[model samples]
Target chain A: QQQVKQSPQSLIVQKGGISIINCAYENTAFDYFPWYQQFPGKGPALLIAIRPDVSEKKEGRFTISFNKSAKQFSLHIMDSQPGDSATYFCAAESGGSNYKLTFGKGTLLTVNP
Target chain B: EAEVAQSPRYKITEKSQAVAFWCDPISGHATLYWYRQILGQGPELLVQFQDESVVDDSQLPKDRFSAERLKGVDSTLKIQPAELGDSAMYLCASSQELGQPQHFGDGTRLSIL
Candidate 1:
């Protein structure tokens, strides 16, 4: 079973617009939620992360809004740029399993300049 | 900045051939992981190691896939008699310790004919 589920397999946004991607997880044991960005021919890079204790975390133009009670989290990119076109994956990890991550399928975002 | 290193950025092998990929984690990092990603999907963990010992490998196809981290620094993943279905991107990641964010390498893309 897929432990994490992501919505909008693909997305398109104009430059300067806000691009959002959402993810939901089933396991309540998950405490750490992170987002990764991957470009073609490269590995996924850590974008932003949040712990269950925080309702939101922001890093530069990237922000992660987490709702622990709803078992959901979303990533928001302010002023999306063409360079932001890539695949994004949301992941969760629990303390009990040595912090092994379970990932969402992915969301391919395209930012039109 | 410290980063994970991987060799042979891309490889193409015929079905039934043997293949191997190498990874070198950041210095002093004790946790290592190997993940497989199919097209349009998120990466899935195949094996995880804490130093030279494997902590999890339940998703690995033991009959044909094997991994080793002898010195607790670098790792090698091998597949014998590969199948067409084995074509995917093999990614290696490392972390300082449990619960820490993981850093990923560019990954080795494998194509099985």
Candidate 2:
């Protein structure tokens, strides 16, 4: 039923600019939200994650802003670089179901240098 | 620096052929996951295992798909008489335990003609 929905199937940003992707989830049971980055021909890599208890979590230039009340979350990449060109996926996990992750379709990001 | 390992980075076979993929989780990780990712879509879990036992396989197509993890370490997923619709990327991930972060392998791309 597409528990998690992501927006802007594709994105383009200039180097050093900020890049953002948004996601919304329908299941209130979800407590853990994570973002993953995938390069072509490779697997998705864990980027950043946040729990319902935290409104925001930052790692290096990647940040995840989560709003539990709204059932929404977003990823922000500060000073996006060419190296950041890849696909990003947002996922939600509910502990009640053994932490099975439900993922959003994905957003293809391109950073032009 | 440890990572999950998957064999046969890419596989191409005709429809109705039997195909198999293998995965080896990181050391000390007890939880394993197998996911299928269609082109331009997020990965969906096909099965999950904890210590050689399946914790979930609700999304798995039991009619043609089967997976097993023996000795609580490596796992194998097999599909018999594969269909054209089965062409996709097969990803394997592992975690230390329930609720922990998962690490993914490069994945095996399967193309069924």
**TM-scores for chain B, listed for all candidates:** 0.98, 0.99
Q: Write model 2 residue lDDT over A1-113, tens digit each, in one string.
A: 89999988999999999999999999999999999999999999999899999899999999999888889999999999999999999999999999999999999999999
* Complex DockQ per candidate: 0.90, 0.95
Q: Residue A53 lDDT in model 2?
A: 94
Q: Give the TM-score of candidate 1.
A: 0.99
Model 2, residue A101: displacement in angstroms?
0.7
Q: After best superposition, candidate 2 residue A71: deviation in angstroms?
A: 0.8
> What CAPRI-style quality would you assign to candidate 2?
high
Error of 2 at B64 (Å): 0.4
User: Please, what is the TM-score per model?
Assistant: 0.99, 0.99
